[model samples]
Target: MLNAITITQIYVPDQDQALDFYVGKLGFEVTNDMQFGPMRWLTVALPGQPDRALLLEKPGPPSMSEETAAQVRELITKGAAGGHLFFRCDDAYKTHAELKAKGVEITEEPVDQPYGIDFGLRDPFGNHIRIAQMKLG
Candidate 1:
C-alpha cells in the first residue's frame, strides 16, 4: 500500500521562473534540479518538510499531444488548469503580509472562515495556493 504522497506536479510555461517564484519567493528548498536529455527534472520542498515535494514541469508532446499541451498552456495562463494547493500555516495574516512584501501575487487577503483564517494566492504559472491557519478544536 502507498504510505504517503511524495511528489505532486504543477505544469508551468517556464521552469526558471517557477524556480524563482517557489524557491526565491515562497521559501521552498530545491530538492532536485537536473536535466535529463530534453526534459529538466525540477522539484522543490518546504524547508521543514523533506518527504513531500512539488515538481515544476513544462507541458509538451510525448506525454501529451502537441495540441493538448497547447490547450493546457492556455488554461494555465487563464488560471483554470490546475487544482489549488492548500498549505497550513501558523498565521495566515502574517504569512500573507510577508509573501506580499516579497512580491508574491496574492489573490485574496486573509479572512475568517468556518475552518480557519485563510488567504489565497497564485503562483507564477497560475497555480492557485491557499494558506490557512486552522482553529483549535
Candidate 2:
C-alpha cells in the first residue's frame, strides 16, 4: 500500500551548482552523494527531515537520449519544465529576509493569505519555490 513519499526529483544543468544553492543558500543537508557509473546520485533533505529527499538530477544519459536530454535542458533553462516545490516555514517574513540577505533571488515579497503568509522564489535552475507560515486552528 502507498504510505509516504520518499523522494522528489528536479533536473539541473549542473549538480555542483545545485548542491551549493540548495545546501549552502537554503540550508538543506546532503542525504546522499555517490556515483552510479556515469550518473551521480545526489540527494538532499531539509535539516531535520531525512525521511524525504530531493534529488538533483542532471538531464543526461541513463535516463534519456542525448537529443532528448538537450531538449529537456533547454526547457529547464527557460523555466518551462514545470518543476516546483512548496515549503513550510516557522516564520514567513523572517525566512524571506534571511534568504534575501543570503543573496537568494526574491521573486515575491511575503503577503498575507487566507491560509497564512507566503512568498515565492526561484532556484538557480529556474525551478519555482514557495514558502509559507501557516496559522494553526
Candidate 3:
C-alpha cells in the first residue's frame, strides 16, 4: 500500500538555477544530488520533511519526443505547464515578506480567504507556489 507521496517532479530549463532558487531562496534542503545515467537525480525537501521531496527535472529526452519537449519548454517559459505547490506555514504574511525580501517574484500579496491567509509566488522557471496559514476555528 502506498503510505505517502515520496517525490513529485517539476520540470525546469536548468537544474543548477532551480537548485539555487530552491535551496538558496526558499530554504529547501538538498536530499539527493547524484547522476543517474543521462539524468541527474536532484531532489529537495523542506526543512524537517526529509521523507517528501521535489525532483527538479530538466526537459529533455527518454520520456517525451523532441517536439513535445520543446512544447513543454515553451509552456514552462510562459508559466502554463508546471503545476503549483501549496505550503502550510505558521504565518503566511511573514513568509511572504521573507520570500519577497529574498528576491522571490511574488505574484500576489497575502490575503485572507476561506482557507487562510495566503500569498503566491513563482519560481525562476515560472512554477507557482502558494504559502498559507490556516484559520483556526
Can you write out model 3's per-residue Cα lDDT over 31-72, one digit (the tens) per residue?
999988777889999999989999998887766777998989
Q: State the C-alpha lDDT per candidate.
A: 0.89, 0.94, 0.90
Top lDDT model: 2
lDDT for model 1, please.
0.89
In candidate 2, what are the lDDT values of residues 1-137, reduced to their tens digit?
A: 99999999999989999999999999999999999888999999998899999999999999988999999989988889988999999999889999999999999899999999999998998888999999888
| lDDT winner, 1 or 2 | 2
Candidate with best TM-score? 2
Judged by whole-model lDDT over C-alpha atoms, candidate 3 comes out at 0.90
Full candidate order by lDDT, most accurate first: 2, 3, 1
Question: Which should have the higher TM-score, number 2 or number 3?
Answer: 2
Q: What residue pairs clash in candidate 3, if any at all? A: none
Residue runs of model 1 more than 4 Å from their true location after superposition: none
lDDT of 1 by residue, 8-108 (tens): 98899899999899899989999999986667888999997868999888888556888998999999989999657889989888899999999998999
